[model samples]
Target: MPVDEAGAKAKGGRKRLIAIAVVAVGMLAGAGGVYWYTQRGSADHAGEKQAEAAAAEGEAEGGEGHGAADADPTASYIEVAPMMVNLRGGGAQAKFVKVRFIVVAAEGKTDAVKGRIPVILDALQPFLRELRPEDLNGSAAVFRIKEEMIRRSTAALGKGMVRDILIQDLIQQ
Candidate 1:
């Protein structure tokens, strides 16, 4: 039998080239998948480390219930401000609002959030002063201030540093 050597070699070379291309593409895809997985794993590990550090700090801060002297007794105190809320009009009688609340650090956070309380208070002072009894027409202005205080506390504390804002006394006159 006669053989077409040229055609045979061409077909074999084409098949070999196709096989090499397929293998290279698969390898590249696999490498890309591995890279993505590694990056995602690193990010998850970093988050876990942050969480662990936070938990450890919480454990260190009077969490073991060791001594009363070391405990944060100031956690009981609340700052207060008594201000008048003027309405939009000049003739209307303004309402007097007495506000008091305590802010505490979030879990595993230091007292640095307290240091920023001044900023939070500054944001609050104007908001409270500008309030109108009409604004509290729904009859829950105290709740509103508490919510705003928590939000401001969080902002001052860098997103999650404030645990809560306990409203100690709210008197509307």
Candidate 2:
């Protein structure tokens, strides 16, 4: 009876070992699948970028005579004149801010966009003056400032006129 009991115990231990091995294999297979899926996505993204670059190169080589079609509609940019404003919230001493930017406009709207610079400045001045030093501390802050500038410019120049705002310079003293 004791010999039979020991044999049963050995069989149960073997079964447990087999179960653990199977679970480990399953986990490894799942990890491998996830890794393969992510790598596949990255490969696809790289392929797409390569395709785009190839298309751009082909256009450059083949579209030399088609000047109108070759022109990028989003290439027009209107430079905003430099602006200086006194910043608020710096105790008794006044902190000043200087900023210069470019407004990206639809092609052929350079003159109209340039004419609206004063209005854009008017919209921007108040916001610039109100900014505290802490508000412009990082990339996120700069992005927020650009977005605000775009919104203000769009409001002043009407929707779809200004595509983006490029901050040329920003200084605080």
What is each predicted model's overall lDDT from 0 to 1? 0.57, 0.70
**Best by the lDDT measure:** 2
Residue-by-residue lDDT tens digits, candidate 2, 1-173:
99999999999999999999999999999999999987885676455444444443443333334223235655577777899888777466576767777777766777888888888889898889888865755435555676788788888889867766666556555
Candidate 2 colliding pairs, count: 0
Q: Each model's TM-score? A: 0.46, 0.56
Candidate 2 lands at a TM-score of 0.56
Worst 10 residues of 1 by lDDT: 60-69
Which one wins on TM-score? 2
Whole-model lDDT, candidate 2? Answer: 0.70
Candidate 1 on 1-173: residue-level lDDT in tens? Answer: 13688889889999999999999999999999999987895676455444444443443343344212235554433343443444443534444665655565555554566566677777777777777645543324544566676776666556866655655545444
Off by over 4 Å in 2: 1-74
